[model samples]
Target: MLSGFFRLEYQNRTVLGEWKKVHWLKWKVSIGLSTIN
Candidate 1:
């Protein structure tokens, strides 16, 4: 039971990390576009 909980926690962390990276990329792209305009 403990192991299952830990696995779920780990998966959540991985998903959160991916989401952060995607958001960061989107932010950078917006900034770049604004600068170009």
Candidate 2:
């Protein structure tokens, strides 16, 4: 049971990390576009 809980936690972290990465990429793109304009 403890192992399962840990696994779920790990999965959540992985998903959160991916989400943050996507947002960060989008943020960088917006900044680049603003500078160009």
Candidate 3:
């Protein structure tokens, strides 16, 4: 049971990390585009 809980937590962390990376990239892209225009 403890192992399952740990796995779930790990998965959540990974997903959150991926989301943050994607959001960061999106922000950078938008800023770059704005600057170019």
Model-by-model lDDT, in order? 1.00, 1.00, 1.00
Candidate 1 structure quality by residue, lDDT tens digits, 1-37: 9999999999999999999999999999999999999
Error of 1 at 5 (Å): 0.5
lDDT of 2 by residue, 5-36 (tens): 99999999999999999999999999999999
Off by over 4 Å in 1: none
TM-score of candidate 3 on Cα atoms, chains taken together:
0.95
Local error of candidate 1 at residue 13 (angstroms):
0.2
Clashing residue pairs in candidate 2 are: none
Listing every candidate in turn, what is its Cα RMSD in Å to the true structure after a full C-alpha superposition? 0.3, 0.3, 0.4
Residue 9 CA displacement from its true place in model 1, Å = 0.3
